[model samples]
Structures are given as structure tokens and as C-alpha cells.
Target: METMIGLPFTPKVLIVDDKPYDVKILEMKLREVGCQVAIATDGLSAIEETRKFKPHLVLLDIRLPDIDGYEVCKRLKNDADLKEIPVLFISAYGDVTDKVRGFESGAVDYISKPYEFEEIFARVKTHLMLRSLQIQLEEQNKRLEMLVEEKTKELVEVNKKLAMLDATKNELLQLVANDLRTPLTGLFSVLDSLIYEELKDQLTKDQLKAYDKAKQQMLSTLEDALLLTQIDVSNTDRVYGEIPIQQVIKQALNNVRPIATSKSVSIVECEAKDFKIFGDQNLLTRAFTALFEIAIRFSARHERIQLQLGTFDHHIELSVYVIGYTIPPDYIGTFFDLSSSARLNILGGELGIKPAIVHRIIALNGGSISVKNEGPAGVLFIIKFPFI
Candidate 1:
């Protein structure tokens, strides 16, 4: 068992000297100021007392019986267990060379023979306080390291769970999309037969017209649903290549030409020069078709819907602006929203899923689609594609 010769407020100190009177005076004074003293009259005894007593501070006399104080301090400092113990020397050698030699041999402080008790105590207290602060800081660093390690482990587990959940969500979306498309296909086939084939003669003109409208609406909805499953964000299927911007625009214009002509809405195409984008061509064509259809449907009779294409920085912009129409400012924000039904009253029918799907397709290709005001004149739909 370890001995507790030291009091709670006192630190153990080792004092080495050959003079009994000097030793008695220092021992009494140090003990009075809350220091537990261990006396060693020789260098060998001082080294032994340091290992045994584990003193926090040591006061050694430079001239001793067995070995000098410098030799004792060096030996104590060399030992692994005793190296951190602060050593102070009391000596008659007051020259600069003696003090430097004492410090180089690992004495923290070297005091001359005629020293005051207050000065000794002050130096001892300062060194002890510094050592105490060092120990506390080391402990705090260990605790902080443990906390960082634990938090990193927690984050790793959370990321793993999130990845698994994402995979499950994507799988469910694919299965439901496949299930819904099968019935939608059957309905489209039946509508085609009833409107154009077997039942054409038996149905009245009003009934035929109604069936045709229903067929068109269902076909439009089904087309959008199929497009959703094709891209779906998680789907990595891509047939990306360099596709000319004008070629896709021409195909879109051709598809929407009949609808535009029927509404007496003329399109003015200010063509883009040598503009190319790297993406799926078929999807891009559909996006352009949606923009053209929206323009034609909303334009007033004899109104000119302007199509302008130009390069801006690293991206190309294809804009469709209506010169004489302005949608409600509030509805402009909701136009690109997938669930908004405000377009139903404006279009005289539901807007279907055209606008939102086009937005998604552009975003999937690392591009953007926006509807914004064209000053006092109508609104503009801008489609952006970054050049590859």
C-alpha cells in the first residue's frame, strides 16, 4: 500500500543536504508552508527518496557526501518514472556557469545558499500549477477525441440506413408504374377501336365526338405517366449523344404545326446557329413539343408566338414568348407545379401533365425550364441546355 505522509493541501518535497542546521531550518520552514519533506543527506539518498516518495518538487545541495547535486538531478531525470518531478538546487556556487550547468542537468530552478523561504515557495507553487494545468488539458483532449469517434460511428450507421431506404423506394415506384401502365395500354387500344373501327357506324355523331375527346385526354395522361417511369430520377438508362438543337425544334414544330394552324397562331422561329447539347434526343423532342403545344393553346387568334434561340455563357437558351397573352401573375408560379389545377379553367380542360413533365426532363438533363414575364407584353417560357 502507498503511504499518505503528505497532507491534502501539501505536496511531497525531497530535500538533500549534508549540513544538519541548514536541513533543520529548511525542513521546518517548508513543512510550515504546507510541504511534506523527505530528507536525504547525499546524492544517492536523494535519488532513492525521489523514486520511493514520488516527490512533486525536490531541493538538492550542489555539494554532497556521495555525489554532487547535478549528478543526482541528471540521474532522476533519466529515469522514466521520476523524470517529470521538478528539481530545484541550493548551492554556494553563485557563478553563471554553475547555474547553467545545474539547469542543463535538469534542475528547474537553482537557488544560492542564502535563499528566502517565500521565494522558494513561490517558484514551487508556479511549477506545480503549470503541471496541474497540463494534466487537465491532456484529459480534456482525450475526452474530445472519444466524442468525435462516437459521433462518426453514428453518422456512418445513419447513412447506411438511408441508402437502403432509397433503394426500396425506387423499387416500389418501378413496380407500381409497371402495374398502372398495363391497364392504361388496354384502355388506349379499346378507345382506338371504338372511335375509328367496329362501332363507328352504330354510334351517333355526338357520341362519336365525345369518345374522341375522351381518347385524346386518356392518351395524353398515359403518355405523361410513361415518361415519368422512363426518367424517374433513379433510372440511369440513357442514350446520350450530341443532338442538334434545331433538329429537335423542327420535329417539335412539325408535330405542333397542325394545332397552331387550327388556332390561327403563327410561330416565328429565330433559329439558333450550331447549337448542340449532349442528352437523350427523344426526351428532348418531347420537352420541345410540350412548350410548342402550351404556346399554341394559350395564344389569342392571329397572335404571333415568338421562338428565339441564342447562347448565354456555357448554356444555350430556347425561348417561346406569347406577344399578346398574360396568365395571372399568381398562376405563373403554379404553372410549373406538378399538382396545380389552375390551368384547367384557363385551357377549358385540364392541362394534363405536360408542363411539369417537361420541367423534370430538362432538370434530369442538367438543365432548367422557367416561365417568366416578358415586361408589359405576355409571358416567356425559357428552356436552358448546358453545352457539352
Candidate 2:
């Protein structure tokens, strides 16, 4: 079967020879294999057409009228535009010196003539096939390089836009949340007063108890929202000082004590007695606050939540474990991802406790956190900080 393998445009060949019959024969042979041939009867015409035609390959005759093939090959090689094109020398002088000269003059191959008709056909076909493959390879490589460059540029542009959008979003959320804090705090105070004043003598004991519990939960939600907003605007890199492990864990435990009491859950604090680490007090307090809230909300009724702290190798580690309450296995790895906040809300869960934001804050202070679903009961959140 004949192959229809040529450029969609045309596979051009420039044949340089002074003989009319030789040029015609070569032209006819090349056209049989799907190539467009251009004839140049002199060296000067060859050079001129090389510039204009920009042929994919060149066939040259050594004994030209003006410049010999050796000089023509040298001149073609020296031209930057034509240097990459393959040149095959067609010569009648089959001497070894002529062959050597052809190679040294930059011709890729030398063909001796009076050449056999089939040999000429075969040699030209081989060289032209090679040239076509080479051209295709070069074009493919160029396209691949272009694709890689375009993808890299797109990634850089996307990252730049994301950084800008992140900054704007943080600022906007901070403003809105901050503006609501004062009023929310006042509302809590007003609720407290109303509960005592309006229902002092009119309510059954169970009704009063339920109202108080609901009121406390509302205040807890309000605090979480305010802290989350503040975190958005705060610079996470600023570490305050050494907060003794005992004090940090104790404070976190105290904040969640009321909720734990309501749920009848026990908290076992097992911090290393003397361990201390440098960190931002408010930030660490908030981190534990979120963790403690998670324990209180997720632990089974009458279950135990244990807080353990220890120091090892210039790092402080804290482990919060809730007994008998399991986090879903799939969520263990990315439970702290900021985007998981939406998932949590969708499941009718907490509003402001974003694991992603918490992870970022801890990371900024040279610390890390991980949650694992394994062991005795439920999930274990492990936090480690570099002892500064």
C-alpha cells in the first residue's frame, strides 16, 4: 500500500543540479513518493531558493556550473536558517576523497552517479523519510514544551488570584463578625436577667432548668463565633510566652466543664506536671477550647474524655481522647481541613469550629494536629508543638 505521509501543506524538496536530464529524473522520482520538488540549475539559484522555499530537505549535485557541491554544502551549513535541513550529495566522482569531502562539507549522505536507478530512488526515499520523521519529532517536542509552559503559567496565575481573594475574604468576615460580638454578648446578659426576673415565681422547676441549659448553649455558640472571627484577622506568627501545660489544659477543661457536667461526661486530665512550652496564650487557649468543645459534643453519655500532655525531644504533645464515640473513618485524615466546615454544618453540627482554621493557627505557631479513628473508643486528636 502507498503511504499518504506528507505535510498537510506539502513536503518540499530542493534539488540542486546543472544537468536538465538529471534534475528531471530526480524530480519525477521524488514526486512519486508524495513530495513537491523545486529545481535549482545553479549553486546561486539553489542558495536563493533555500531562503525562499525553506525546503524540508535538500539534494545537491557535486559538479555544478557555478559553485561545486562541496562549497554549496558548506555555504548551506553556515546559513543559520538552513543548517538544520539534511543535505544529500549526488556526485559522479565515486572516489573515496569525494565521499570524505562530501561528509566534511556537511552533507548527511553521499550518492555516487552514474547511480543505479533503484539506488537513487532508495537513497532519496530513505533520506526524505528520515527528514520527515525528524521534522515531526521536532514539531511534537515544541508543542509539548509549549503545553508545559502554558500549564505552569496558568497555575501561577490561579495561585495569585487565590491569595488576593483569601485576603479580601478574611478581612470581610473579620469585620462582620467583630461588629456582632458586642451586641451578642449584651443579648446573653439580657437573657440571663430575663430568665431570673420574669420566671422567678411563675415556672415549674423543669422548665426553668431547661431554659438555663439552652441559654448556656447559646452563649457557647456566640463565643465560638467571636473567636473564629478574631482568628481570621489575627497574625498567627506572634507567640506570647511559655504557658505551663498544667495551666493551659486546666483552663480548657474549665471552659468545657459546664457542658461536660450537663452531659454527665467525665474528663480525666493527665498532663505532665512540669512540662511547659512557648506559645501564644490566647491562641493555645482557643485551640484547646475548640478541641474540648468537640469532645463534649461528640462523647457518648456518661463517657470519659481524657487530656494528656507530655514533652519529648524539644516538643510538647497534647492528646485529647473521647471514649466510646467514633468519628467516621473517611473523615479522619481531612477532619481538620477548612473546607470540612461546610460538611460539618451540613450534618447539622457546630457552626464556628473549623478544623482547617484551627490547623492553620497551630501550624503558624510551629505545631501540628492530627485526628485518628482507632483504639478503645471514638477519635483521638493529637497536637504537637515545638518547644521554643
The root-mean-square deviation over C-alpha atoms between each candidate and the true structure, in angstroms, is 7.7, 6.8
Evaluate all candidate structures by whole-model CA lDDT and list the values in order.
0.81, 0.77
Clashing pairs in 1: none
lDDT of 2 at 273: 80
Which residue pairs of candidate 2 clash?
325-378, 338-356
Alpha carbon RMSD to native, model 1:
7.7
Poorest 10 consecutive residues by lDDT, candidate 1: 1-10
Q: Write the per-residue lDDT of candidate 1 for residues 225-331, one digit (tens) a residue.
A: 66765666455667788999899998999999998888889999876578888788888888888878888766878999898899887779988898666677767
lDDT of 2 by residue, 63-167 (tens): 889988888889999988888888988888899999998999999898888887677656666776787788788899999999999999999999999978887
Count backbone clashes in candidate 2: 2
Candidate 1 off by > 4 Å: 1-166, 191-207, 233-235, 239-244, 258-264, 278-282, 312-315, 323-325, 341-349, 375-377, 385-388
